[model samples]
Target: MDTTILIVDDSQFIVDGLAAILSRKGYSPIMAHGGDECLRILKSAIPDLILLDIMMEPMDGWETLEKIKGDPDTREIPVLMFSAKKITPAEAKEHSLSIDDFVSKPVNPAQLIESIQRIFSRRNDIKEELLLAEGKGVDPSLIKEYGALRKSIEVDRNLLVVLRSAVGRDQAGRTPSPDEMAAVRALEEKVASSERRIRELQELLARTAPPAGQQE
Candidate 1:
């Protein structure tokens, strides 16, 4: 449920700065110094979104993105091309299916965050569309409730990510501050509750719908 973002850049400064910014905003940010490292990380873990730097040594962002899209395991992860270089509309159209969005270099902090949110929103909409397409005669309101609960879980998970950052739990993974401990406990509970509701909604939808050939 945690929204983990992979910040792929050749420059250590950029990756670190972006990671700091994202962590402060309650999103888990993982750093990959170049295309190779990014591919390596993908083999083990798939982040929710990838902020890919276009210019790099040895393998550029476009090549890296091609490899990413070529692999079935990693193909579906959304990518936002980050670079200082200007891309033409023709180029954008050429790779439209490969990447979700693009951001020029020296991104505005507020606008960057907004862009990331928009990407996630689009992902949610796509998921809802797919689910709805598969579900005939399922209550539209019920699907909406499922989506809302899923978003609630994501929020709680982000809060947990924030608390982890606050206490440096990722490194030592030991005792946390009392306040953080309490907050983490509450978030865990909230996430669990939302997950349970999602399951219930799933079951309800499954039961209320007619078989594939039969119309409601």
Candidate 2:
């Protein structure tokens, strides 16, 4: 894969291990041993994704994250918090808007991979119909609706991830309790609604597209 991931950590051991896993999974990894190095690397080369450790000396992950997000040049890169630190619900909620995702240390390789894949799917894979409709002369309102639906889908997906992580059951091959199941189901329903609206938008795009030789 051409996708490059920058892995920033204070520990060489963690960096090396993560690099190995990412390499075997077909990702090219750029390594940085500290927050300063990570920022310096960002100056010259921006990777497709970043795995940032949260507990560094001098500059912790939050500081680094704020700097990264504050910079217009590097703000758009998806960041995943790779740390052993327990993220309390409040911290997670506060940072949810800033982070693409997080993978707690004692890293479950499967969970890490899944989170990366989901982020890529969400951020990188723009809907073909959306692109085509934008290129055509679709009504601005229609395009706005499509954007809203896609955003709704993204919100629901994020909620699903947070809920599953909080319950600590989805990935363990164990059944979820009734409460967890109910929450998951509600999110799933919202996702389904958004998806259905997206399909309708696609069909409307097809119908409303300008005729051949007249598209502008």
Candidate 3:
């Protein structure tokens, strides 16, 4: 079955353009002009994925994403945010938004398609893990731990982005300011801590996991 993708953007041009791209890639696109409309559509039918724009009337993508993630019914659906405004990893970290991915505009067709495919592939892997655990009579809490680890990894990766941006030289090739350097150091420590936690989680899951072809 062709995947259904929900696109929420205030601009008709962007909505139409993204819809065209996804259609050619063999996906059905559902369009919403604003966050309210997107939430309304979601009440009746949840799409396989959502391509959301950060800027919109009455409700921005941040608020909309919060609502989606907060809801029990729609929280699992992956959302990819696209925007003309540069949303730095620092901002995303501060907001604590559970975004699957971010694509900056104007959108690159190949990158957009690749990101979408990657997300679907990851979700499929998680679903398979869930099925395996169920068959083996493993504790369901393990699956929840896996999901939490994934989110932590994503957050840390974004922090790395912020660190990179902070350390980058200015347009004139001048060195980063002292404040920027300090920020980079702080971010580095956070990323290191997160990486260590991620490793611990992976090892725990592996040790506790059922052996191949074995069922409890």
Better of 2 and 3 by lDDT: 2
Best by lDDT: 2
> CA shift at 66, candidate 2, in angstroms?
1.4
Q: What lDDT score goes with residue 135 in model 2?
A: 75
Model 1: CA > 4 A from native:
137-216
Please write out the lDDT profile of model 2 over residues 1-216, one tens digit for every residue. 399999999999999999999999999999999899999999999999999999998888988999999999999898888778765444554565578777778788898999899888866455555666777878878987886576456655665676667756556767767876676676677678889889998788778856479866
Error of 2 at 53 (Å): 1.8
Ranking by TM-score: 3, 2, 1
Candidate 2 clashes between residue pairs 3 or more apart in a chain or in different chains: none
**For candidate 1, lDDT tens digit of each residue in 1-216?**
779999999999999999998998889999999999999999999999999998898889999999999999999898887787655323443554577666777977776788799779967774875476356666667766776565556544544554455555565757767765565576677679889888897777666756568774
Error of 2 at 194 (Å): 9.0
lDDT of 1 at 176: 63
lDDT-superior candidate, 1 or 2 = 2
- The TM-score of predicted model 2 comes to 0.68
Question: Against the true structure, candidate 1 has what lDDT?
Answer: 0.76
Itemize residue pairs with steric clashes in candidate 3.
Answer: none
